[model samples]
Target: MTPTQATAARRSKISPERAQELYAAVLDELREHGYEALTMEGVAARACCGKSTLYRQWRTKPQLVAAALRAHRRGTLAAVDTGTLAGDLREAARIAAGTSGRDTRLTQALGLAVLSDEELQAALREALVEPELAAFGAMVQRAADRGEIAAGHPALEFLPAQLMGVLRIRPVLEGRYADAAYMERFVDASVLPALGLAPAP
Candidate 1:
């Protein structure tokens, strides 16, 4: 079977009950201990399951963390319904920045872990970055279909970075709220125009 199908099969083998339990335990461990300290042993201990069970499914801590990220993927990208590019992007930025803001701990921790391991970085991108960007890309495509932006817009794929970057840097640079409103202003001033939308008010 293909890799994804194999993953699906293994996931299916995991009783929904046990799967959620394992995932929850792992996330809690991440929240408390940070990524480097998060181990399969730790997760299995907290999950009250054997380490083999986690290893059978994930093989490594990076894989386990990557899966956990997939399980908890959320924010504006998850429910974007705005018909207009500007509106959609504003919400997208607001949501994308979420992980970098109050939930900043996880993002920061992941950043450190990824930098230390190229393989883990790839897996992290697959689990975290690619999915979110793909979701946002669909919105960008829809905007192009509506003539709000160019499909050929060079900055299209970089939308995720633009949205998340500001938030990650805001605390370091300005020490302010990168809230929905802040994200909105971002959409109006920088992102929208970059995608060829009209400048913000």
Candidate 2:
């Protein structure tokens, strides 16, 4: 079909606001009921729409879940410019912690579902992981361009890993939360020194 025809077909599916409403309802359903129990019928009923409506938007369960993830992709790291590299790194760490904290339960469900399904894993990565990585890559690239770090610096690729590491390990390691204070300290003590960027004078 032509581009215009494709556009028309998509428009006929659902309005943007309605699609967002459906996506939000689907995510809530996934959160309350594990992905194993999540069904398009249930999502349709919850969203007060019809099964055909759900099908029109997303033909498969993974596709529907993927759309839900994409629709609600505002996981922290939205606004993270603090002038100094140390400041930006601190905010970046907090953003990582905040994003996980905000969506941990739901993502846990997604994780469970992906463990048993390959298609779901691919869908999840494309829908959620890729976008997040893309956003972070852009920031890291900008930092490099700003001469904060050399392009080939080992620390560049390690930044996201550090952010994720702290979030993933805090509760398990210290039996404590990775709060903003902890995130800030991680930047000050560990992240900054690693990047060769000393703390503010």
The digit string of per-residue lDDT tens for model 1 on 1-201 reads 965566667778788888878888988898888887888889999998899988888777887787886776566485786778777777777676555553565666665777888878877787777777787878877877888777887888778777778877777778775777787888898887776777533
Model 2 lowest lDDT segment of ten: 2-11
Best by lDDT: 1
For model 1, the superposed segments whose C-alpha errors exceed 4 Å read: 76-79, 97-102, 199-201
Candidate no. 1 TM-score: 0.84
Off by over 4 Å in 2: 1-13, 73-79, 172-177
RMSD of each: 2.6, 3.6
Best by TM-score: 1
